[model samples]
Target chain A: MIELSDVHKSFGSKDVLRGVNLTLPKGESMVIIGGSGTGKSVLLKCVLGLIQPDTGSIAVDGQDVTRLRQGSSERDAFLARFGMLFQGGALFDSLPVWQNVAFRLLRGSLKRPKSEAREVAIEKLRRVGLTPDVADLFPAELSGGMQKRVGLARAIAAEPEIIFFDEPTTGLDPIMSGVINELIREIVVEMGATAMTITHDMSSVRAIADDVAMLHGGVIQWSGPVKDMDASGDPYVTQFISGSADGPIETVR
Target chain B: MSFLATIGRTVLGFLAAIGSVTLFAMETVSHLFRPPYYPREFGHALLQIGYFSLPVVGLTTIFTGGALALQIYAGGARFSAEAVVPQIVAIGMVRELGPVLVGLMIAARVTSSIAAEIATMKVTEQIDALTTLSTNPMKYLTLPRVLAATLVMPVLVGVGDVIGIMGGYLVGVERLGFNASTYLRNTVDFLEFLDIVTSLAKGAVFGFLAALMGCYFGMRSGRGAQGVGRATKGAVVAASVLILAANFILTELFFAA
Candidate 1:
């Protein structure tokens, strides 16, 4: 299980996340929805230790993560258990698709000969609906949708127990987004991985999420199963999902 | 505007910058010799730092050598000693032009390229992606470039010295009406091996300095396009200044006595 309690974070004088609390049960998919400038990404970064909260407790499996000291072998072991798909595909431009997919496996203790790793990479690519021949192409040559699929392949290549997706369907065409959403749903359910995704696409919520949370006023305004998401009744969740700009989510500028 | 205060501020800033760079350089050297060495990346750096650099460094050396020959011949004509052309050309190319020209060439070519490339990577989240994959950016990117340049530059300078001297030799023998044997003999007799050693060593030092400055500034560059541009400019200026400053200090250390 992943749990965040009273997380507070600010950038200089601007408060981005204020006393936000949330929990995702094991082997379930939780999606957080918010406006563009809302703290959804910041919350994810905080969980990944990319950013530190001012005062909060973020625990994975009940271990306090907000204050976890890093770089120890034990800490590295913990870090290795989680996989993430960045907003941008973020594949290494220098490497071909297969190499990018096998990046983690080709480093550290998991490293093997190039042929062995490439075979594993190709299998993972096939799982994400990419041809083995496409593995030789660089990231720059691939279209946006292809890159996103390659990124997903890389994320699940090592098959971590926990995974996080940031804007998984952004920049994708409707059909491609639906395909990616279905793939994400299938992967998480088949692997029984605890998953957290941050996005505004309600279609993604319906396709992949089991539970959903709404972030507003630097806090989680409401959360429930995807079945109850439409009737959340919280004005913020309603306005946000309905794509209304004339809501409580005001622009300070 | 007190002189001591001004001097103190400059010294303090310089020290801080050097201290930070020293720590980073140490980290780079450690990572270079450590396992998980990226041979593929090193080959790419070799292509970028050495192979692509040859034309620019060669062209600069040839033109500078020809121009130096003309200037020296003209000045020596006033003393009826224009025949000293070949000797001075040989020494100039071996002792100074080879090292300084190569240094400046790398500062302009390699430094800016590395800085711009790394800054782009930083802005586009590639470096962060490397970290997420558990690859150290310095180990993967910076060390290979620095190491390749450090190893390749001396050979480049040695080749440039021969080419620049050929430019001078051709000009002196054909245009200045000097006997081929006399000019060749003078060049051979006047140049010392230490001159060659000093220049080559300086070339290696300068190459390392240029690439180091590029990677350092690029990594430290602020976010956004404007930040990347500023970092690229800063890397070029810093690399150029450091190369010239190191040249003078090395000259003093090698021959001041």
Candidate 2:
């Protein structure tokens, strides 16, 4: 289980996350939805310890994550349990696709033989609908959708216990977005991994989430199952899901 | 009062920048001695920062050597001391021009490349991805380049010294009407061990500063294309100025007596 309690983060004087509290039970799929610049990404990064919170506690399996010393064996072991797909794919431009996918298996404490690592990478690529030929190409050579698939392939390559997807279908076409959403749903269910995805795409939320959390004003305005989201009477959630411009939640802000 | 306030802010910003750079340098050094070293990354950096830089470093030093020979010959002629060309060129190339020119060339070439590459990675979130994959960015990205540049610079300086002296020797023998054998002999006999040692030492220091500046600016770069551009420009400028400043201080330390 992952728990965030009263998480508050600010950059300069601009507070991005204010007293955010949420929880994801083990092996559950929780999707966080919010408008742009509403600190959805910041909230995710805080849980990953990529951004330190001003005054909050983030506990993964009851252990405080922020206290883990960087570069220590404990920290490495902790990080090894996570798989993250960044918004832009974030593939290593200098390396070929297979190497990028097999990066975790190829180095550090999880070192594997080169041949074995390559085989595993190819298998993971196949799982994400990429061919073996695509393995030799660099990230720059791939299209945006192909790069997203590659990023997904890398995320699952390590078979991590937890997966975080940040705006996974942001730049893809509707068809491709559906394909990726289906892939994510299938993979998460098959792997039984704890998943936290942040996206404003309602299609993605319906396809991939077991529970939906609406983040507004740096806090969870509403939290419930996907079925309950439609009938929930909260004005903010209603306005956001309907994509209404004028409501109690001001879009101008 | 407003002008004084602006001046004070500028001074404080400059000092803060220095402090940040110093801390970054110390962090890089600490990571150097830690385990989980990436030999493959280090080898690639060696090729990128050292071997690939030969043409620029060679070209800069050779032309400067030829120019130094011509100027020394013309200046010596005014005193009827034209025969001093070979010794002066050799000393100048071995002691000063060779290291400084090679250092600046590296600052222009390697430092800018490192900064741009790293800044792009940062912008793309590859550095953060590395963290998620259980890797430390400083260990995986910064240490290898810093170590490779520091180890390979002395060799580059030594090669630059030889090429520069050869340029001077060619100019002396062909353009200045000196006997080839006599020019070579004078050039070889005039250079001392301390000159070569100082040159290599300067090369090492310059290489460290250059790579350090690149990593520092790249890591601290802000978001977007403008940030990457600023980081690249800042890295080259800082590395070049620091190399020149370090050269003067080292010269005083080595030869003040």
Candidate 3:
């Protein structure tokens, strides 16, 4: 389980996160939806300890994350249980696809023998619908959708207990987006991992989210079960859901 | 008052840059003794910064040495002191041209490449991905390149010094009507043990600065293609300037007495 209390962050004078508070239970998929530049990514990075908050606390599995020092063994252990899929595929351009998937297994605490790691990578690739023939190919050789699949394979290869997806379907076609959303939903359910996703795509929100939280003005404006999202009654939620330019939420920056 | 304020801001900015680079170098050195070392990455960096750099280093030093020979011979002829060509070339190449030229060449070639590659990775979020996979970017990316350059630079300098002197030897005997044995004898006899040592030591310092600037700028790069371009440019410029500055300092330390 993850809990954030009054989390506040700012970049210079621009307040990105202003007293955000939320809870994500174990084995549940929660998708945070907000407009561009709304600090959705910042909020996710804060939880991952990639960005330090100015105030408040973020607890993952009942342990305070903000206090974890970088390069500490405790920090490594904390990160070992989590996986992240970036907006871009973010695959290592220099390494082959299989090596990328098996990256976690090839080193660090979760290391395995080379042959075993390669086999696991191939299996994960298969799980993500990539063939074994694609294993030796570099990420630059893959198309956008294929790269996303490769990224997904890498994310799940370690079978992390928690997974975060950042704008997973941002650049894919509608069909590919649907396929990826389906894959994410299935993977989260199959692993029973606590999943936190940030995206503005309504289709993706509906497809992947078990619970939907609307982030506006750096706070969770409204949050409820996925079924309640359509009828949440909050103006910001309604405006965002309907993709309206006119609403309580300002369109212009 | 406004002009003074602008000057003040510029001075502060320059100081801040120095402070940042100093901290970065210290952090890299700290990580050197830490566990979870990446030997494979180190090997790859060695091959990239050392082996792949040979052709360019060789070509640059050889031409400079040849040019230095011609110029020295021309100038000495005016003084009726043409016998000094071989000795002057030996001292010039060994003490200054070899290390300085090799350092600048590395700044142009290796520093620019490292900066561009790492900056692109930053823009694309590969560095963040490495962090997610429990790999420290400093350990995986910066340490290897910096360490390899620091160690291999002396070797490159040594090679450049020999090739450069050979360039002078060829010019002296084949073009300047000097006997081959006499030119070789004059070149070898003029060079001292301390000259060779200081030259290699200068090479080590230049190499460290060049790779350090590359990793420093690359890691701090801003967003997109413009960011990568700016980082690469900054890296080469900073590395070249630092190499020149360091060369002067090392020379003073070695020969100021």
Candidate 4:
């Protein structure tokens, strides 16, 4: 289980995340949706311990991750169980596809022998719908969809207990996004990983998430099962679901 | 007022970056002496930061040496002492220009490259990916570069010192009227081991400063191409200023007597 209690974050004086409280039951996929700058990404980052919250307790599997600073042995142990997919796919340009996929398996304290790691990398790449030949190529050589797949492969390579995805479908075509959403759903079920994904893509939410949370005004405005999202009476939810400009959520400019 | 604010902000940012680098560097240096060091990464960093820096450092120093020869020749003729070419060239290049010129050259080459590359990685989220893989980016990326720059700079300075001397000798023998043996003798007689040591120390400090600026700005970049551009620009400016500042202090310490 993962939980955020009364989270608050500020940059300079502007609040990005304000008193955010949420929870996810074990092995559930929760997709957080909001317009740009509504703090969807900030919420994900807070959970991942990438950006520390000013006042919050982010607990993962009963561990207070937000307070655990990096470089501590305890923090290292804490980090051992989490996987994350960044918005841009974040594959190391310098490393080949296989190396990027199996990065966690091959580097630092988790490092295995080179040959074994290579085999594992290739296997993970295959699992991501990539060919064995593609494993030798660098990320710059791959298409955007391929890169996302590689990122997904890397996230699940270690069989992490939890996974976080940030705007996973932001750049892909709707078809490719659907394909990735299906893959994510399958992987979550197969790995039995508790997953939290932040995205504005309604199609992605419809395909992958078990629960949908709407972030607005720096807090979760509404949350429930995917079936409840369209029927939700909240104006914000209606406007967002219909993708209309004339509702509670309006364009900033 | 805006211009002053710009200067103040730049100074503050530079200081903050230096402080952060110092703290991280302390942790990295501690790791350096501890067990479980990454020998392979260290070797690669040495090649990248030091060995690769030579061409730029060498070319910069030699040309500066040649230019110094000409300038000193012109100035000394004011005193009818144009014969001081050998001594002045050796002294200027070795004592001041050699390390400073190399430092500035590296600030232009290595700092910008490191900043732009790392900043791009950061904006692309690759650094975050490194963390998810249980690899500390600081340990893997910044530490090796810092260690390599610190270790290999003395070697670079030694080579630069020799090349710079040769530059002066070539100019003196070919362009000026000085005999080869006299110029060589003056160069040898005028230079002390302290001068060489000072230059080497400057080299290490400047090299560390340059790489430190690079890594610091890169890690701190905001996002996107604009962020990376700012970081690159900041790194070069910071590296150049720090190099000059460190050179002055080291000069005072070495030759204050």
Candidate 5:
């Protein structure tokens, strides 16, 4: 389980996260939805310890993540249990597809032999719908959808207990987005990993989310299960779901 | 008062930048002693920074040495002491031209390339990916390049010094009516061990500055194409200027009367 309490972050004088409080139980998929620049990414990064919050507490599995030092053994052990798929694939351009997938296994605490790592990478690639031939190719050689799949493969290769997906379906076409959403849903279920995904794609929310959280003005405007999202009777949730420019949420930054 | 405030702001910014770079260099050096060293990355950096840099370093030094010989001959002739060509060329090449020229060449070639490559990596989020994978960017990226450049620069300088003296030798014997054996003898006889040592030391310093500036600018770069462009330009300029400034300081320390 993951928990956040009164999380606040500010950049200079501009406050990004005013006060965020949320929780995700184990083996659940929670999707966060908001307009552009609503600090959806910042909220996720805060949980990952990529961005430090000004105030608040984040705990994963009863361990206070805020107290863990960067580059510490404890922090490393903590990070080992979690995986993240970036908004952009963020694949290493210099390494081949297999190496990128097997990166965690090839180095650090999860060190494995070269041949074994390669085999594991190939297997993960297959799981993500990539062929064995694709292993030898570079990230640049793959299409955006293929790269996303590769990123997904890399995120799951370690079999991390928790996974975070940041705007996973942003740049893909509708068909590809559907495929990715289905893959994410299946992977989360099969792995039984606690997953937190942030995206504005309603199709993705319906396809992948077990629970939906609406983030607006750096706070959760509404929180409920996927089925209750439409009938939640919250104006903010209604405006966001209907994709209306005219609503309680301002369109302009 | 407003003018004074603006000047103060600029001065503070300058000092802050220096402090930041110093911290970065210290962190990079600290990683040198840590575990999980990447030997393959270090070897690749050696090839990229040292081996690939040879042709440009060689071509530049040869032409500069040839030009130095001509200038020294013309100046020595006006003093009715044209026989001093071999001695002056040897001293000039070994003490100043060889190291300085090689340093500037590296700033132009290796510095820009490192800055551009690392900056692009930053923009593309590869650095973050490395961090998530438990690989420190300082260890995997900066240390290998910096260490490779620092170690190989002395060798490059030695090679440049020899080639440059040969350039002078060719010009002296063929174009200026001097005997080949005599010019070569004069060149070898005039150069002291101290001059060569100082030259190599300067090469190491210059090389350190070159790679350090590249990594520093690259890691701090902003987002996108404009950011990468600015980082590359800033790195080359900073490396080149630091090399020249360090040359002056090292020269005054080594050869001061």
Candidate 6:
């Protein structure tokens, strides 16, 4: 289980996250939806310990992750159990696809033999619908959708206990988006991993989210199951669901 | 009062920058002796920073050497002391010109490349990815380049010194009507061990500052293309200025009696 309590973050007086409180049960798929610049990404980063909150507690499995010292052995061990798919895929351009996928297996405490690591990379690539031949190419050569798949493959390669996907369906065509959403749903269910995904794409939310959390004004405005999202009578949720521009929630801000 | 306020702000910003850079340097050096060293990355950095930089360093030093010889010959002619060309060229190349010129060339070539590459990586979030993968960016990225440049710089300076002296020899024997054997002998005999050692030491220090500046600016770069452009420009400028400044200090320490 992951829990965030009263999380607040500000950048030079511009509050990005304000007193955000949310929770995800173990092995649950929680999707955070919000408008652009509403701190959806910041909420995810706070949980991942990538961004430190101003005054809050982030507990993963009842352990306060935010308080862990940077570069500590405990922090490293905690990070090792997480798989993150960054918004841009964040593939190391200089390395080949296989090496990037097998990066965790190749170095540090999780070191594996080169041959074994390569084999695992190929297997993971196949799991994401990539051919063995694609393993040799660089990230620059792949299309945006393909890069996202590679990023997904790399994320699950370590068989992490938790996975965080940041805007996974962004910048893809509708067909590709559907494909990725289905892939994520299938993978999360099969792996039984605790997953947190941030996306505004309703299709992705319906396909992957067990619970949907609407982030607005730096706080979770509504939280419930995907089925309840449509009928949630809160004006903000209603306005968001209907894609209405004029409502209690000001679109201009 | 407004002008004074602006001046104060500028002075404070400069000091803050120095402080941040100093802390970053300390962090990088601290990680240097720790475990989980990436020898493969270090080797690649060596090939990139040291071997690949030979052409530029060589070209600059050689031309400087040749020009130094010509100037020394012409100047010495005014006093009928033309024979001092070989000794002056040898001493100049071995003691100061060789290392300083090579250092600046590296600042231009290696520092800018390192900064641009790292800044792009930061912009693309690859550095963050590395951190998430249980890797330290300082160790994986900065240490390799810094160590490689530091270790390889003396070798580069040694090579540059020889090439520069050879350039002076070419100019002296061919253009200045000096005997080739006598020029070579004077050049060889005039250079002292202290001069060579000081040159190599300067090379090491200059290389460290150059690569450190690159990593510092690159890691601190802000978001987007503009951030990357600023990082690259800042790195080259900082590296060049630091190299020149360090050269003066090192020269004073070495030669001031």
**Per-model TM against the reference:** 0.90, 0.99, 0.99, 0.94, 0.97, 0.98
What's the distance in Å from true for residue B103, model 5? 1.3
For each candidate in turn, the interface RMSD (Å) is: 1.9, 0.6, 0.6, 1.4, 1.3, 0.8
RMSD of each: 3.1, 0.9, 0.8, 2.4, 1.3, 1.0
lDDT of 3 at B119: 96
DockQ of 5: 0.64
Per-residue alpha-carbon lDDT of candidate 2 for residues B146-198, written as tens digits (9 for 90 to 100):
99999999999999999998888878888888899999899889889999999
Estimate, for each residue in B1-257, the C-alpha lDDT of model 1 and write its tens digit: 69999999999999999999899889888886667688888999999899988898788888777877888899999999898898899898988888988998898899998998898888777786676565668888999999998988998898899889878877877887778898889989999989989989999999999999999988888888998999999999999999999999999999988
DockQ, prediction 1 = 0.43
lDDT of 3 by residue, A42-108 (tens): 9998988888999999999899999999989999999899899989999999999999999999999
- Which candidate order results from sorting by TM-score in descending order? 3, 2, 6, 5, 4, 1
The native-contact fractions of the candidates, in order shown, are 0.26, 0.91, 0.74, 0.80, 0.43, 0.80
Winner by DockQ between candidate 6 and candidate 3 = 3
CA lDDT of each candidate? 0.88, 0.93, 0.94, 0.85, 0.92, 0.93
Give the distance in Å from residue B197's predicted Cα in candidate 5 to where it truly belongs. Answer: 1.4
Candidate 1: stretches off by over 4 Å: A5-11, A52-57, A62-72, B1-19
Q: Which model is ahead, 3 or 4, in terms of lDDT?
A: 3
Best by DockQ: 2
For model 5, how does the per-residue alpha-carbon lDDT over A1-253 read when each residue is reduced to its tens digit? 9999999999998888989999999999999999988999999988878789999999998888988887788888888888889888999988999999999999889999999999999999999899999999999999999999999999999999999999999999999999999999999999999999999999999999999999998888899999999999999999999999888888778
Docking class of 6: high
How far does residue A49 in candidate 5 sit from its true spot (Å)? 2.1
Model 1 residue B99 distance off true place after TM-score fit, in angstroms? 1.8
Expressed as tens digits, the lDDT of each residue in A23-71 for candidate 2 is: 9999999999999999999999888888888998999999999888888
| lDDT agreement of model 1 with the native | 0.88
Q: Which runs in model 5 stand beyond 4 Å of their true positions? A: none
